[model samples]
Target: MEHADEVYDVIVVGAGIEGSSTAYNLAKFGKRTLLLEQFPLPHSRGSSHGQSRITRKAYGSRDFYTQMMAEAFAMTDELQKECGEQLFINCGCLVIGPRTADFLSKTKSCLKRYGIPHDQFDIYEQRKRFPALSFRDDFEFVLDKSGGLLRSDKILQAFQRQFVRYGGVLCDGEPMIDLYPGTIVSVKTTKGLHRARSVVLTLGPWAAKFLPRLGLNVPLQPLKITVCYWKEKHGGNFNIENFPTFTMNGAAGKHHIYGLPACEYPGLVKICLHHGPNIDPDNRDGVENDWVLDAMKLIIATHFPSLEKEPSIVETCIYTNTPDEDFVLDVHPTWKNIVIGAGFSGHGFKLAPVVGKVLGELATGQKPSYDLSHFKINRFFKTKL
Candidate 1:
């Protein structure tokens, strides 16, 4: 069906956290913006539908992200004030690992370099502080005071609402099927064609499907990750009040194992392995994987004796990873007006606000507020396309 072509100053595809954040920024800047989503609002098919996500400043030596987090946190605070809703909870976070692990020492050094308040807890101190957590004798813990949990689902909703309130147009259930890039980009979606002066592609796992059409091929792997929630055998042991968000790095051969304090599910805490099997995003639900579940059970039985060895509930989420696990935010080499944001890996949610702002600035031909050279797509251009 051909509908009337309505031109917009900017059109953002993939209305997840990144897309919504971009649209919100564009609209707030007084641009005639349009936001499009492939699925219905509040759907569980994508990565942003989760109830909670850990937000922290410690990035295991990634100081660039630590610098960007300052702005991201401030932006989130502004959004909370504007929406008049509680969007974040500062519950602190602990990174646990063996004393010899470089990640632990590097993270502690990074925190110290940034002057972020943190505490180092040896096995004895750890036991005294967080009795619910159990670890090996040689394990060391670093507490990040700035870390906490973000209400991810609510943040999406708040961004969309504030975007519309700022006069941005939102078109749900309209997936961009084709793009004709030129002086003015023509976006063809499932419902209709829309013309825009500039376009921002925050297409998440779907980036690999569309970027080829633009004559750019970046290595992006979409993995289906299992999110597990375990039941606490003793009530109040791992609840939100006392327990802090936690991560165990260099576990099970350098794979990250992380968890959040009990909040979403009563008497249940969220925990999962960070790495998963690569799979097609369309067939994410049917992918077979049991090793992660088995690993989580073993981890819980070994460390979290208070929690059940078996997960009470298991859900799925997708992660689009780059080789370096850093974000890809840059302008299209051929089409300067087109901005691309991809390969956030699994840690991009905490940086979405700054990412969106940078993407919007790129689309509008403005100087970005922060240094984005690290995130440029050129880093991956040397790879065989």
Candidate 2:
């Protein structure tokens, strides 16, 4: 079933946050862009389906992200204005850990370095500030005032809507079975073969298998993270108005945990480990993740006395991680017109605006504003393109 091969200025495969954002930016730039997605719109098959994601200006390890978040925050506000809808909640982001945790110390440094508004609370002050949960041990808390939660579904929808309003074509439920890279790339999807002067790949977990077919391989491991929710037992300040989005770094070789206050489900708090077992995205359900649920239960019981120990609801999300946690945002080593955005490592939803902006610039032969040295393919440990 081949339709008319209307050659577009750019074709972006994958309607996830990154790809949708790339198409949105391209359309905003007045480029004739086409966005293709394998799954149906609003499907829970990828990372972007998770209802809420944290958006913050400070990074514990990467300074580049800290610097880029300045624009990401502004872009988010701009997107909200364009959509005429509230896409985020400014509840702030609280990072809780031991006093000596590098995440705490480095994140504090990043806040001061970036001049992001933040407040530090000692163990006693933290207990007074947040009385809903108790720590296993004395833990200091750092609250990034520039951080908050993004309404994931609404944000994705806004990108698609704005992209279409800007005259970009968005096609979903049509999987790209093959790609032919050249001066004018030909993307062979299930429905038709689309032609474009340039292409951007942001296919999430599917990229691992899809890229190998193009004679290029990189270190993209997909992990299935078990997202769990617990019922609120004690009537306390567990609502978003009261509780902020929070992350707890592992103290001593334990699982790093993060959660959102009562947003995804009613009377149930979202909490899970920041790690998961690697698996093929096509066959994610085959992996046994009961151990992850066990870990969450222990975490909840140890800290969150207001919530039930046993998870009332369990869900899943996929994270495509590189050996290094940094993202892969660069052009194909051989094909200059084909740009790649992959290996977000689970923390990229907040940074997609900058990533998409840079990817759009690369696809359109425009110079990227940010320093992409940290995200280049050559820096990859495997280094095979």
Candidate 3:
């Protein structure tokens, strides 16, 4: 009856937010879960290492996702209580773009559709309210008070801790080398070959490494994103009291740029483009391109005039983006017990808790809490062989 040496109810690969959440939920549901990580714990090699991530309910017209935020926020609350730590801060977020632009218009529409309380401020009002931001008259603002920053690393660690609290096994620093999918999955890692009843691949940038061998090809673009910290001209101009998380649209050289208050890196505030140069996650060597840094500095100088021209600190992270900028969540076509979650692009952090819940549901053959239509594995049908 043994398919391999030993059996587990579920095995999850990748210890990022998605993998940890899936393992946490599976263990909470009484499944013997094994969470695997290629890198050592607390490594900054992946996308989930940052201190702050913006969380909001604003979407263009996607009411379903707008509604999902309620549950996502609730889950964050549950995580905070379970971990006995504060993970979210309601610092408010400002969405600045043209009134006719997709980002701005959709945000207002979604806010109205859900009757979510938001403030509509004019150009003058925005400039008056937030002196740190100096926008042209053409730009408008949609302020959502409910949105704020999530202590991202804390959230991931909380999930990992919670998963362990629920009797889940965590195997870090062991990269998953191979997968033989069937009713039971045989995973080959640097440590050894392990077997489990079901396997969930949330490998992020490394997803294609194992998936293509199984005859499934997805159009996932791996890019290197720059995380930069700019020094304050007045030393505390970008402090939390003066600055909240701001999302700027229609910025030159990039569509969106987000910045957190100067709480993470001392006198430096985190700001960078939402996009980055295409990169291979395996060989993310050398420093970032000067153009990317220049673009961000230009925006900071033009908009956030109070920040020092030079970036105080800089780091890099990899994002495995899908073409449509949506997520891919489904069981492998050839192996039903093998679940996959990828194509998170740049915005996967906020939905990590809920995504983990859905991945757990998929692995257990239970219906997911949210709609799975927009996030199907077959979206890349033409690309898949």
Candidate 4:
């Protein structure tokens, strides 16, 4: 027998979007799943809180992600029926960078492979198509027509609700104290000890802390990123109707810049850099991020003249990044039944549905749906630790 008190087939720790999505899939697959969360139902401490997130099939180097995004794009239609709410906004996502930039070329390769209706311009003459900002000849433009914005907070709520409807047990405000791995994985939480056939750790920023005690050393860095929204001088220039989601590579040296249309707030657009300083997830406040604001202002003054130089509203989010910025979607090195889904690295939100499916498959001892060589657990050698 697995365990006398094994009440669930799979236990998912961390009820963030990733964990919630995984629990939803497990419950839908008739797995008797249990989901645990440290915080309350909806909180802004983790990576899934922001109201708007850009959803696109564009990737820099990984075409498998583009394939996964295609699958993810299809799942949104299914999510609408389950949630009964608008989940996605259909505006193009534009990638702005140098023609010779590695990220742009790699992204172009994926776009070309799928024939996703993206156009690349050698000349800086995109004012007719998108007139919000000025373009430079040195920077290349890749217009991804499939790009849009996801109602992030609403999607998170929808996944959790669907998980509950599918017969998944969710316990919030209860943190996991410890986890034991075996044929029957047992998790000790703040309230009580729970046992299941498998455990999935989607701990977000808490991954670096908890993974080590499992005897697995993962290089997951918890970063504190500032999400800023700037106001457009014109009334509706950057709104969802007139604007497109955009990504600017090499904004401030190595870090990149990304933006979404004005949906969360009325006239403010969400444009921020993909960079932040390291921080402890438990203690997220009291960090200095003024330098990020300065860099963003410079970018706006140079490129986005329609928007105000200073941000109108500001917020913060966490990113559990790997050294390579790729997600860690494999199982535990020793315990195959215990799965680890961390290191989303800020860009994992759009792929949560597929990630959850993959984690569920791994938990139930089934073959993965897509190629996972890029997400292998041992990709980062122990020496790097």
Candidate 5:
């Protein structure tokens, strides 16, 4: 493909889930959008790789997320229809935590407020139903019917294809080296210089590197989290029928452990810490730390007794987390034409579809379909004082 010096209506940086979805939405509106990526297409170097991601409307505190999931599900459904492929598989999800914990209580509140069907079970009942699970008396589990697994890579490819079908241009293997934010945002890329009416930066972990230069000081901590898959002792015990995706909360001061049923790798269940060790994305390929690996092993022993002590497959993924763990979605204070989406905090994949539409609306100067107050960039300013 030849590089052309042309001005697009919108320039989207980063071809991850958020960027691809936003580009697709813009192209659907017949806008000349350019999707940019630093790495070549379909590379596992980014956070958006992997076979499946848990997609569930199991927000404990953010009822707004539940509201957004309504639109997200519809949008994903439309994508599946247009692509003639099944990207979201409905396998349900099991959210387990102490009833007294904020996670479980707030989730129940959100479920009731949104009328999302879920079954609340005590620990005894949960242990009986799913014999592979073991929990104490204080812990309660909710079976969320609206949750399922999302084929992330396939979804990205599907959206990219749909965006092109709608006449969108994608420049993969190109990095945005410089950006001139003005009425016409000029972007200098490896391929060539391209101008666009508006720019949306959804660069995931690399967002902070450019955001501060744009007069937006977002304190983002990029952490390298390990994606460990533990082999199940009895393969059928972790099957989709017997096992469901689980999010576990420990007693006070203990971190959370979440896992998905066996699917990606046969006999291996995907599990990872809700938090991670702070590290740079460039050096994320280093050898795994013994302390972290031991901690994960302990978690599996305490929670999932049916899984092996050691992880059969270990991979690395990065997360840009915010202090409050909510997302940062807003326009730059100086450049209204420039929109930013960052600090997904490890739970952004399930909300990418709705977030893309919202980010696209912000870039295009259209009224956002949902309230943007919760995810505004100005919130951090209030905390500084």
Candidate 6:
């Protein structure tokens, strides 16, 4: 490990999608950037190591995210061209829910407002178009042509590669132990101490450990989500070539149920409950609770009769959620040189590019390109840190 005495322009802790994207942007802009990762590259311990994530501009109430998706998609395209490899596969998406559901209405309105091409399918049309899907008679479906699946693991790898090519230093297997906040922040890792003009903390579920040291309290809850994949009763019925990514709003009480087409596992579709039990990130395994699995089985049996009731393969991932389920993207309260990007709330992977850019801008003392008032930390607290 090269522990140089020189101060870096920016040091990004956590080499997940958000941190990697920020490092790429900082390095591209000619900043001396260093990315620190707790685990080795391409590990499944973090949220960014998934095979696929839904990328869409069909946000329900969050129109800012919809607007940001325009740039996010563009950045994805730019990265794809630069890497000469496909990162996103546009297989379309279906947003299905009750007609009276506010999320459905808001999503449809948001899509129309942004001039994104979309279509609404009634019960008869939906049945004719997707014969395998079983929904209530009053349920509605919206087809978002621009939405699809993003290869999350591939995107993370591409971003890390491009960041290195652009002159960014990446230190894997080096966990940040402490932070000495100041104009020039001192980042103490397990191996050595590194100094940076600014620090960006993109810690996923481990933000709670470092936020208090920085004298900030953000209501962040880390959840252990159950990623369940069910086998198709008939072969090739729910494969990527035929089925589109989908979400059922208000499916199981307060939470939404989402699923991706079968791609990672042959003949098995990835369907999961959007919410899960709270658990520690370090002790994520064997933390008791199977409510999510039970709910998945019920939903699949009720709405997706073509799929098997039992999950063929079950996995786990973590989601750090905020109170309002939005993101926290702002500079630290007391430390101006420290910026934080947290509380992704399960929907952050799609916006990693723009999120990284915003974090980089904040770290470099540059004005953010987008309106971030919705993501400010003050929304959670009245007094300034």
Q: Rank the candidates by lDDT, best first.
A: 6, 1, 2, 4, 5, 3
Q: What is the per-residue lDDT of model 3 for residues 221-311, given as tens digits with 9 covering 90 to 100?
A: 8888888998887776677776678788888654688888887888898988888887777877554577788899889888888888888
Runs of candidate 4 exceeding 4 Å displacement: 1-6, 122-124, 252-254, 382-385
Please provide, for model 1 over 1-385, each residue's C-alpha lDDT reduced to its tens digit, 9 standing for 90 to 100: 6334467899999999999999999999999999999987878887788889999997777789999999999999999999999999998888889999998999899888988899998999988888887877899999899999999999999999999999999999888889999888989988988899999999999997789889878889999899999998988988888888988885644568999988999999999999899988888877778888877887888788999888999999999999999999988888999999999999999999999899999999999998888888888776522
Assess each prediction's global lDDT (C-alpha) against the native.
0.90, 0.88, 0.85, 0.87, 0.85, 0.90
Total clashes for model 4: 0
Worst 10 residues of 4 by lDDT: 121-130
For model 6 the TM-score comes to 0.97
lDDT of 1 at 256: 81
RMSD of each: 2.1, 2.1, 1.8, 2.1, 2.5, 1.9
The CA root-mean-square deviation of candidate 6, after full C-alpha superposition on the true structure, stands at: 1.9
Selected candidate, larger lDDT, 4 vs 5: 4
lDDT of 2 by residue, 1-385 (tens): 7444478999999999999999999999899999999988989988899779988888977888888888998999999999999988999999988887888899888888878889998877877888777865557889998788999999999999999999999999999989998999999999988999999999999999988786667789999999888899965567888888988896334668888988888888888899898898889999888878777777887788788878888888999999888999999889999899999999989998888899999999998989999998878645454
Worst 10 residues of 1 by lDDT: 1-10
lDDT of 6 by residue, 1-385 (tens): 7455488999999999999999999999999999999998878886777889988887877889998999999999999999999999898889989999888899899889888899998889988888888888888999898998999988999999999999999999999999998878999999999999999999999996668777777899998989998998988778778778998886745468889999988888999998889888998886876778888888888888999989989888999999999999999877889999999999999999999999999999999999999999889887755
Tens digits of lDDT, candidate 5, 1-385: 5344477889999999999999999999988999999999888776788888888886877778888888888999999999999998888888888878788888788888788998998977977788886667888888888997888888999989999999999989998898998989988898888888899999988886778878778988888878899998877888766677777777323668778888888888998887777766667666456666777888788877988888999987888998889999899887889899999988888899999999999999999999888898888887631
Residue pairs in collision within model 3: none
Which of 5 and 6 is ahead in lDDT? 6
Give me candidate 2's TM-score against the actual structure. Answer: 0.96
Candidate 5: list runs displaced more than 4 Å. Answer: 1-5, 251-253, 286-288, 383-385
Question: What lDDT tens digits, residue by residue, belong to model 4 across residues 1-385?
Answer: 6555456999999999899989999999888999999998788989999788998997867778888998898887799887889998888888888777898888898888788888787543677666777756677788889988898899999999999999889899999999888888889988989998899999999999988898778889998898999998987778788778988887645458999988888998899888888899988887777888888888888888999878999899999999998899988878888899999998999999999999999999999998888888788995532
Which residue runs does candidate 2 get wrong by more than 4 Å? 1-5, 251-253, 381-385
Q: Which ten residues in a row have the lowest lDDT in candidate 3?
A: 1-10
Cα TM-score per model: 0.97, 0.96, 0.96, 0.95, 0.95, 0.97
